[model samples]
Target: PRWRNIFKSNATFWWSFLSGIAQLLYVFGYLGAIRLTFMPTAYKTTHYRQPLLDHNGIDILRIESGYVACIFRMPSYDPSLPDVWQTDALISISIALTLFLPAVAIIVICSLLILRKLRIAKSTDISPQMRATQHQLLK
Candidate 1:
């Protein structure tokens, strides 16, 4: 009952609650979409490695220095690995915009309204002490 009254009376509290809920929903939806789109494979390695085989069931070595030459197989998309960071950044931006933009707008508007009200109140007040101070300052 008390919490309900607080939410009803406080615009800031309502904005925070709604923003948090929106953020949680966006994150869950994004995660669910990622899961549905990219099914996890048994081996998630980006690169595959194959050792050179010899006739004796051992790795073949170079004749000159006797060092094995390892073969690495990279996916065709390996060159685009840096784009993964960009995707993460995009997701971060989306989440921030969704979660914070409305709350920030509301806060800014509320602050402006409060400041305007204060200014109006100050202008309307004609206290004798304030009038005396104004006269002194004029002199």
Candidate 2:
């Protein structure tokens, strides 16, 4: 469609309209929201065993002992689930790759096509004004 007719695209025009509903559904489903499953928790490993002592060998900084505020974890998660899915890194990387790969591929392909078109427009004897307008609109 022409640049001016972009806003007047018909209902069947799917390329111009980008919706987030699919991503939302996929993300929620993949994360097991419907099943009330909260997998992949952080694990606290912070520790301080060395205590500061005064001249008399008394405990100077008596802050606390075993106070771990560093980690979160999926404590008491279901054991029936696969171990691979329980890992945060696996889930995150897999979900991102699966959801975004197709979109990224489509964008790259469309960008190449537009670039080719622009090159052709430039190679031809088209007015520089028209070429600039096309480039701007494509962008």
Q: Which candidate is the best by lDDT?
A: 1
The reply for model 2, stretches above 4 Å from the true place, is 1-4, 7-89, 125-139
Residues 1-139, candidate 2, lDDT per residue (tens digit)?
Answer: 4865764443223332333444454566555532222221222112111211211232323435422121123222357864222344445556656766665555566556556666865689588898899999999
Off by over 4 Å in 1: 1-92
Total clashes for model 2: 2
Estimate the Cα RMSD of every predicted model relative to the unseen true structure.
13.1, 12.5
Best by TM-score: 1
Model 1, range 1-139, lDDT digits (tens) per residue? 7878876566555565655665566667655544432322223212221212322233323344443322222224456564223243345446545645665565566666556666866777668899889889999
Taking all chains together, the TM-score of candidate 2 against the true structure is 0.32
